[model samples]
Target: MSQPRAGHAPVRPRAPVIRRAAGSRAVALGVCASEPSHEAGAAAVARRLALPLLTSGTDPRHCTRLDALLCLDGDDLSLRQTGRRAPGPVRVDFGAAAMRHRRAGGHNELLGRAVGVGKKTPLVVLDATAGLGRDACVLADLGCRVTLCEREPVIAELLQAGLTAAARRGDPWLDALLSRMRFYPGDARSPRVHSDPAADVIYLDPMFEPRDKYAAVKKDMALLQRLLENSPVQSDAGQLLDWALQQPVARVVVKRPIRALSLGERTPSHSIAGRAVRYDVHVLRSLN
Candidate 1:
């Protein structure tokens, strides 16, 4: 006798597929043959991050396998895309001309005012989401002992490399500014960050959703977006805000999009508005 047909059995529901971001996903640590001196540094980074290290005469530009390459290009360690039409490399360069210009132009008047830099004694700032360390560098330039907390390993590596490069330059002004800044490579919500005695002002700059329509996002920002496309923290800015509020700090400052709703839907004590962004100040106690 023929067996009963299996098609009569009940069918189980299929699991939804998890989709990854578009474009190449493999990234490697590459050291150019033009500069043999950077091999050791690149190798160390590769080992540390457990990423593949590409050396020899292999040209990163023509290497079709890698989507991106963390390269030790001469004096700078930069993240460069491998595609022919990719944007330029991105690096955390605190000594860049733009940063110097900003420093000279009153060191970001609004950020300084929002952080209570000149308004009060030199404060200790805990930058909870120190992406590129740009704002932390600014705060340090304004005489605040700024602790930079970055959970992402790649970004922390970039910040460390930038600091190392800047330190080797022996520039007095740059050294003085960097002296007040410290990089903490971990989550800001951990007990390690909360136990920091120097944390007088907790600053949160959680990544906001891109708001511009016609204007192309900045190169560095676009790279960051791609890097953190699948990050859990990307959708948990409210949680970060809530944790910052519970810290034993005199104030918590949140950098937000100009028209976006308040973080966690909780109103700030007051807000300092700028052209493109605003500082939502949550005053817990007197800075006195």
Candidate 2:
């Protein structure tokens, strides 16, 4: 990641105080292979993330010391927790039945409307916080050329693998959607991202601690939360919104929990609300 402008630094968001349970330890992440053929790929990923590599003979779930494992099994990549009580592994699958149903039923209207998707020409979208590239995939399916930017190495690797496998499936309809998507495994706030002057809209889905402590989160989100708890990259959410607002684009859209306050406490030009989430639109100019 590039340093913030010489004299100016990003305003860091106040770090949330986290409390750990008694006897709980920090997350121990590693990479492992479930088959001999996948060992090489697993080893490469382990090297990239600087994580320990468990040989193919070791069952990752039985490795009690390792809290999580990135497994390269067959053609798919997934993240699995070690304990018997742990939730199922999380992986990105654009070809999953749920995503397929959503695409077929045209149920992603809120996201499309938030980004002004029905423009005369397809819009160029920069997804600043492409967690699993799910929204980015939706935008691509909606006819937008989408660029996904993810800073975390582990998450980015999983996302890239998912895209690669989807492409290899040899499905024409899926191919068309994949063609419009590009992955950038780095900071979206970097100067390199700014060099792309073609993006009409920038989308941000800054992750924060869920407000309701007892609320249930999806499996993927739970794992990501655990990973982030140990992650070193703690870029301020406020700084991200600040950066996006300064970008030369037609508009910026931020996804926020419906009850959460506006990002940076700055009022948006308008907002589109759903049952649980809201899209806050900061319009700099008309799409026309």
Candidate 3:
């Protein structure tokens, strides 16, 4: 989740790009790679992404040939398209309005404790499932070094693009913060976060399949829901939980909505609450 980013528009006005090849339904992270009937412009985007052609709608006839669905947000827009929307509580531009929204029966307080802005532990965060790189930025703003990990390369590219653009724009702080963000595609299984990382915390915002069916969960959250639904069942939920648990960090923070079950079966050592969401804070006394 990206926090407090402003002064620039999103990466593009249209749907983000994704790989062209068709991987497993769950493994593909909810993206469908098929040739678009409108191959002209779609091919261009595909060329730029260097991924196999993906069809969001699943039916080439419904979507244009050049209409490539790159699965940047996890869901196949072609399958169930919800166009880009205004940033809600999860948006980086979240200001008084969003804070107010949270204060007015939303999840804000919990966010505060988990992302303690003034903490002194050389705050390093490893966002295991960086859906859109928002949370990592928030932690960085709070004086933490964050390493964002996303199993899908398509989303990673967009994140990298945003960070690079932020860097070039001469936002020195954000640029320096970008230096702190290293994107890795795939999970802990890919040998990305294998070696000991310089992080005091390993954060997990794994996909939350909402059962409440509340559409008011904020656009960013909804977008993430759409994006990650296609993650392979083999997605490393178990391994990630275990590895993070074993990390030499002082804590492992998992972001979840209020009353929601833990990411995996294992419970957190402790928790912090926001209005709409709650952070399961697992304190690692071994490190402490």
Highest lDDT against the true fold, candidate: 2
Supply the TM-score for candidate 1.
0.84
What is the lDDT, from 0 to 100, of the residue 250 in candidate 3? 74
C-alpha lDDT values of all predictions:
0.71, 0.77, 0.53
Candidate 1 local lDDT, 132-234, one digit each (tens): 7888888888899888888877777778778877887889988898878777777887777665556889898877754434224676467666666544344
> Once all C-alphas are superposed, what RMSD does model 1 give against the true structure?
12.9
With candidate 2 superimposed using the best TM-score fit, by how many Å does residue 16's alpha carbon deviate from the native? 25
lDDT of 2: 0.77
TM-score for each candidate, following the candidate numbering:
0.84, 0.87, 0.63
- Pairs with steric clashes in candidate 2: none
lDDT of 2 by residue, 1-288 (tens): 111112212222222223233333456777777887877777777666667777675665587767778898866889988777788888888888877777754338988999998873779999999988888888898999888899877888888878877887888977998888878888997777666647999999877654444334776478777666556676477888898888888999998877778888989999998877789999998997
**Model 2 residue 65 CA deviation in Å:** 0.5
Ranking by lDDT: 2, 1, 3
Error at 84, model 1, angstroms: 1.5
